[model samples]
Target: MAEERQRIRVEFAYDGGPYHGWAKQPGLPTVQAALEDALAMIIRQPIATVVAGRTDAGVHANQQVVHADIPADIWATVPRNAPLAPAPAMLRRLNGVLAKDHPGIIVHQIQEVPRVFDARFSAVRREYSYQIADGLARWNPLYRHIRWQHREELNVEHMNIGAQDLLGLHDFLSFCRPRPHSTTIRTLEELSFSRLPDGAIKARIIADAFCHNMVRALIAACVQVGAGQRPPAWLGERLAAAERTSETKLAPAHGLVLEKVSYPSCEQWAARAEQTRARRDS
Candidate 1:
């Protein structure tokens, strides 16, 4: 009989400062390239991985999700419950590969998942955050890479008011780079802004899916409102336009981070994927 295939899911985090985003590109470092290389070494064959989100260049992820398939022969030899107690030998081995070559990336957990689970299509929501170091926050070196340095003062209350207008289902074309062949409609579950204890502005957005540059674009629009350059009502006005707006600035990718991906119960994985794909494709 043919060797059975095992579908495995991995949760990991990476500092995007050195890599060129999550997807592999020619002549550039990428999270996917580094991961596939390590997997190839472990399985003794070429390997492919699917991610829940394709983060832009310079965008970090705290709990990025990925899924891969391997042959039973390869899976049988890898210990699933050894080498570090709960962390399987396979998981430790993969981390070893990451530490040696891709030190910025690390795998936290790995386990066999249902065959129907697809990291990208099966996801129900994605959470992202952006940091702006304005006011006195520019002096913090610890957040240099993850926080954008904005010189102008930002009103957190104003930003929050503008953010509330963006929460809900709408065609976010005004906040996304044009994707002519794809839909821009998305259900924004959450959009809020707060002043971090360190005086930095933290903006969080949650949505079913995002188009190119959407999160950063949304941040920029809200910043303009916070800076008193635009009225809080402008966001709703732009949403009604349903087209890309030249007035909105695109924020730097370095300040954005993919925080998490959520999904339904294992039994509903296939159904969720089906509905998500159908809507996304339409």
Candidate 2:
């Protein structure tokens, strides 16, 4: 049975505010549990999911993808093998199961992908967004755990200048939590800010990979620059220094959202489709 097994890939999204993060915790609800529970109901067996990123609590995912190994026998029980139906119809059933138990969780799409297509390692880029509402309005209850409220006026120009320093490949020791097996090296592809219609400011960042708490720490540094407490040029120096200094502060987790994940063009789409078909038809 293991020899005939194939991997299943799924794209999902969630509001992370109420959970203890993406992974399962001993005493807290998590996105993983919700997904696994739904999968168990569908397949009539325990299911484990592997995510692209184990986002911290209060961090939302606009579109996150995960992969799991499902027996071909299980896949065959769905749409394609059903008297006569297209493969896409399977997604609807999966969503229905997920929606019943996981409120606020949405399964956007599901399809089988190559065994080599690891949700984490195969990802080419990850984009994140952070919202900051300046002044008293940032304290509004509606925005709790989603927006960072700053009661001080900010100098956007200075913040932009500081963020520019993080645009290239560099060792991000200062912004990351030190982990023994961690590599602080990463290439930042893009970073910029824009004002929202509601007078809140948002920081958009994209990178090949991020270190633990890297985005939060980067935002915290930017806030210091915006508030005139840190020189705008200091960010550039920190990126070059590759040193973790005591002054580095990780921003609050609530303000960050995992916006998207990118991958190489689907040259292997044909292979994936064929494998998917076999699993569904078997």
- Model 2 agreement with the true structure over 52-80: per-residue lDDT tens digits: 77888888999998988877776777664
> Global lDDT for candidate 1?
0.88
What TM-score do all the candidates reach, one by one? 0.94, 0.88
TM-score of 2: 0.88
Please provide, for model 1 over 136-234, each residue's C-alpha lDDT reduced to its tens digit, 9 standing for 90 to 100. Answer: 635478878998888888988888887888899898988898667788899999989888887788888999989888998899999899888998988
The total of clashing pairs for model 1 equals: 0
What shift in Å separates residue 107 of candidate 2 from its native position after superposition? 0.5
Candidate number of the best TM-score: 1
Q: For candidate 1, give the lDDT of residue 264.
A: 90
lDDT of 2 at 256: 92
Stretches of candidate 2 off by over 4 Å are 80-90, 137-140, 268-282
Model 2 whole-model lDDT (C-alpha atoms): 0.81
